[model samples]
Target: MSAPHFYLHNLGVPLLLAVVLFCAFDLTQLDVLISNQFYDPLTHTFVLEHDRLFEKLTHKLPRILPDTTGELAVIGMLLSFAWTLLPKGRFSAWLERVRVAPALRWLTAHRRDFIFLVVSFAITTGMVHYFKSHTSVWCPVETTLYGGIHEKREWFENFSLLHEAGEGRCWPGGHASSGFTLLALYFVARRYRWRHARALFIAVMTLGMIYGSTRVPQGWHFVSHTFWSGIIVWLSMLGTALAFYGRERLSQPALDAPRHAPETAAPGLSEGLSVSGR
Candidate 1:
């Protein structure tokens, strides 16, 4: 597909969908209404607020999984860099004979992919957390509807202007961003034309929603907060993809090359022998 076509289908369409959903949530009481379902008026708290099992399985595990993946990507990038620096001698020969050589070569070949994943993941989650810290939007648990001190405010409300003593640190859902940031994997997979790219995309979206929904029952965030997190993470990943891969590369189809293709030269090599020469 052409780059413009890809951008329109992938980035543009999803962005429009995000805008529509944002408007619906902002104009209506959907956030409160959905959160209300999980709220227990009798106990004056979200029913699953203190459910340890639910919290562990849903919230803790989901957040940890993506974090672990990001860490692995960083390790991969480091190893790829190291591989490029190895001298062409007995040591290099022994290293290549090691069982892990194939994996290292794969990483070296796709070092840019690992870099994109790591960078995008950091930027996406970082932006969400930054917004959370700055935005004065309260979590569902902090609002009066769910038995808290503050009056319920629409997401668009100017909480900063109110000069409230306790500025809320829960506008966009941080946990949701953790999961949504995995969408970077989908773009990476698509870039390489992985056979399971569609499946990966669906799985990432499902996982993101699952991670986001877990917070709703715990009153950590509203549905809108989760949706907004997805939107933000999605856009961040898209932006990073564009920055890393560029339109021309993104538009091209993956080459039908061997999985064990020979490793390209690392950065700073002769222009004729560089990784980009691939």
Candidate 2:
């Protein structure tokens, strides 16, 4: 289907789901099941950092992927675009002439998608950070249940806008956005109808899911925090995709470049979707 219709179809339900999540109070239950302060036999006090395994493996590991890996993705995309900016370079010219790898060819065929990916990731990340900074919601670790510093509070209980003291500044998952934002890839893939798009989508989402999960055990965030993050990224990517590629193209081939991007086979990603979202 055309990109505008594709995006129009996809945004409705996700936006609804995000609204539901924002209004619901469904996190304490999962926090009980997932995170807990530890009992210290010697000190007779609960130790917040008792879980050695989660601390060692899961706690900060996500930082590397989202920070280092994310930077590299942006840089790579920039380099791809940079090749075109100079108008000519020996390596660039040679690379352009050769068949290059599918990965490279995919980038070449869908420059808009790459731009969408980079831009969407940055936009979503900035948005996530904005909420994280502006809202007073505490991280799971900061809540009393998770051996944190603050008492329980609603998701948006004391938003900065209300001029109340923020209970804390940790709502929605940040690092998760690193991979979750790649939801743009799913939309980009469908635009091109690339056979491997499904796999790529899954891989990107799994990375985010894995990264988000690690934070739970460390009390860095709540289950709902990550869920909200997924929702946020989906919406962010969708809005960006619509901007880049919402218009219907004429008779261009599926591989022809257009703008915009977003993802998942969960529901909205149907058979009519082609790569370019156009």
Candidate 3:
């Protein structure tokens, strides 16, 4: 496929949708819809909070899953590399014989994947924090709309009118990145065009959604913010995958075709040489 295919189809469409979705969301009351439908006015409670089931689901349960999942990912990579690097030993030899050996074998063949996962996880996740640091968009709990202190501000009201970064850093959700970074796993799995790619994508996204939900009850992120976080990470992962793997797949096959052995005239046509004699 051409370069444009990678940009326009794989990565561009998602980003365009993300921007459009975010902009269109501004026109809707879904934020308030979720707030009002689920939020209790008299008790100032979220209906889901009636039993703290949502609370535990969002606030506590993620502490066990995606939160540690990233660390485990990092540890696993480090262990794979470190153990592979160690001089032959009982433990290292044993590692090569275990269930993990297949993964380690895959890792050995996929050095680029190792770097992509370790690096892109940070890159994709960092964009969320970058927006958080620069954006004035407040969380649901930070605005007076939810019985908080600050007046609600449109996302861009401060442009040109003022210059300081607002205290609010909750625009694109941060916790969600922990889950979405696992999307890198999808890209890695997709490199082999494995059926597991779809499964990995689903698993990682579910992981992010669970983590993203945790902050909602506490008013740290609007549902849309969590949604946006997923979009950003999804787009980022796709783009990075394109960058890392695009040229290799596009060019390697053509280059792999053995060049025709130097073309030569038939023996009879070779500079008047006949087939029978030189």
Candidate 4:
């Protein structure tokens, strides 16, 4: 397959999944109906109100720069073009060998990576769900700045702009978790080649940071939320990598032993004895 197609196959599903998550949060009007108490220090009055996502998008902008869909598409296009331009060499051959048509072999090569992705998604999702039901301290990132001093409110006001938003109620910084999980997977899987491994590791780390920062502008999470979420993700990935690597080492030796030597029939013994006598 062509490079662009290859990348699309690998990355499209993940991107789509993220989009679905963001859309779900935006569409359910959670941002619109959530109530918060705002204190006006000058008037010494507290106002309780519900906030909307549309309002947040229009007014309370994030501190980080916005990314348009068009811009992202263009970037993907350029990256794909660059990948296709690279010359094929020994490294390419090795990569192909590892990626050959045999599904079992490929799975064996990428099992840890696949497991990491699965586990990361499950754990993050579960945490997000569990926290959504029990949190009352106010998303710590926004306790003072967005919600004021009120403690009786069940919901926090959504800041529509990046400038006004605070932290998340549930598991904050979902992006950080997603990005760091992938990073750890790459780090573990790339042990065969140091240079390529380092490059991939750097790329994933950068992506995780970028993803974390977007929470601020998106008005969904705070900086601290992102940081803590990232820590959790990093720890999870590291633990998973160690476990997977250990299991692989213990189970691999039996498979590596040769089953049998090249066979020579009894007739071959007669041919060996007549070599010089004739």
Best by TM-score: 1
Write one digit per residue (lDDT tens) for candidate 3, span 1-278.
66776557656777787778767766677676665655667977655544577666666676566547567667655654653465677766687777665565444444455566777877887777766666678877667887788876655563223344677777677778777887887775555445456667788888788787667766667777777888888877776776776644422212222232112112212222222222
Task: Report the C-alpha displacement of residue 114, candidate 4, in angstroms.
Answer: 2.5
| Candidate 2 lDDT by residue in tens digits, 1-278 | 66555545567677777777655635335444545433333553344455676666765665665566457667666554443344456765676668443345344344555566678778998878777766768875566654556887765655575353553666777767766876876766655555566677689878888877666655577667777788888877777766765534211234433333232221233323323233
Clashing pairs in 4: 32-52, 56-160, 60-160, 60-161, 60-162, 61-161, 61-162, 61-163, 62-162, 62-217
Candidate 3 backbone clash number: 1
Rank order (by lDDT, best first): 1, 3, 2, 4
- How many clashes in each candidate? 0, 11, 1, 10
Clashing pairs in 3: 58-214
Clashes of 1: 0
Candidate 1 residue 263 C-alpha distance from true site, Å: 6.6
Candidate 1 per-residue C-alpha lDDT over 1-278 given as tens digits, one digit per residue, 9 for 90 to 100: 87679879878987898889877898888888888888889889898899999998998777778989999999987786766676668887787777666666666777777778889988997777666655577887887777788886664564343344247778787787888888888877666555576778788888888888888889988888878888888888888887876666456565455232333323312222234324
Can you give the lDDT of residue 191 in candidate 4?
Answer: 27
Off by over 4 Å in 1: 159-166, 252-278
RMSD of 4: 18.6
Compared with the true structure, model 1 gives a TM-score of 0.86
Instruction: Provide TM-scores for the models.
Output: 0.86, 0.67, 0.72, 0.41
